[model samples]
Target: MSSPPVSAPPALEVTGLSHSFGRRKALDDVGFTIPQGRFTVLLGQNGAGKTTLFNLVTRLYSNRSGSIEIMGVDLRARPTVALAKLGVVFQLRTVDLDLSVKQNLLYHAGLHGLSRVQAQARIQAELDRLSLAERANDKVRQLSGGQVRRVEIARALLHKPRLLLLDEPTVGLDIGSRQTIVDHVRQLCATDGLGVLWATHLIDEVRADDAVILLHQGRVLAAGDGATLCAKAEVKDLGQAFTKLTEARAA
Candidate 1:
């Protein structure tokens, strides 16, 4: 006898997504999926519809033309369920300078409706992961840029989100800090079974094994693993492959 179908779900699913503002197309037919326990990079340059997609997924801008599903919950039809399983760290700094690291995280925990006891435990656990347990009482302004960024990550995870979304997470950090943040996130996928949708234009951030969705001029130019995209572009490296594919699209 045939076995019953399993109900496995991707971390995120977007289909036929399109958005615009007064005839200016911000996104056009964007679609992709980020699998659980993997890091997927949303690669696009400035004004390439990356942020627009993020806004739609987070429901900051409702998607009128398509669908967004998070771990099987549709954003439009079940925003509460979808959002509860999703965590976001935008490109801009979100930490309050006056608040201590623990306070900042606790505040987020409270917002997520975690009780004080539950919030304290979760706060300690996440801080420990980022090596910020010792500095929990330190004000955000006293931490380095990289440290602050790590705190933001911990805050995002405070709600115990299954899918994490980060936009240009490494912007303005030095090479060391960037590597640290990147490696830490990849570790989360491997260790915690977290699904990541990391949006960035930086070519170096994409490993050869990572899944990639290339967005260009409000459209998805390509979607697949890095090796697949490289093969499609007929280039040996991601940097060269990106240029080749984008140049072709521009032609």
Candidate 2:
């Protein structure tokens, strides 16, 4: 008889994750797995501890109470190896406005230990991928808000991390720009086999087929495919389902 195939570990996993500041709990035993090659939306409102979760995963805040793993590597035990498989676009913009787009990406590439020739090649490829090739030499201050966001995405991907974490990536853009970013990231998950954890409060961004984790305050209220959550809530759409879930939690 042939041996059974081994399953791949999840792209990202958090188990029994908890955090607190003083007496206020920020996260309470949160746990979820982001499967490889899929888009998972961390759906929540403001103050929902989404950023806290991101902080723990990215090691911005020390994970005092729970475990985080990347590609089956424990984050605390193997920081460098675990972080090597992760990329992040934080909620706040981090690119330098004074530098050209290419310069910004090159600086990021260097931080990841890429030499000049390697950085240049990867930068060009990502610029082309994001349709920002024409803007490569332009100062970041000259780019529009959406273009700046794209630049951040390009910078994050310089190392080709397997898992991408985007925190409220579309918060400040116009609807057209928001949709463009959303569609592009979804395409990455589909075509490039990149696992994504997209944190957002915008209900419209939740699609029926996408994995959805509904978080309120510091806890996960529900988690499943969007279609399943809506069906369970007896609602017509994700928006209504979200409303129902949050309201019940509040009550």
Give each model's whole-structure lDDT.
Answer: 0.92, 0.92
141-196 per-residue lDDT for model 2 (tens digits): 99999999999998888999989999999998999999989999998888767889
In candidate 2, position 249 carries an lDDT of: 90
What clash count does candidate 1 reach? Answer: 0
Point out the worst 10-residue segment of candidate 1 by lDDT: 1-10
Residue-level lDDT of model 1, residues 64-170, one tens digit each, is: 98899999899999998899999999989988999999999888898888999999999999999899999999999999999999999999999989899999999
**Which residue pairs does candidate 2 place in steric collision?**
none
Superposed model 2: Cα runs more than 4 Å off? 1-6
- With a 3 Å backbone cut-off (N, CA, C), the pairs that clash in candidate 1 are none
Cα TM-score per model: 0.96, 0.96
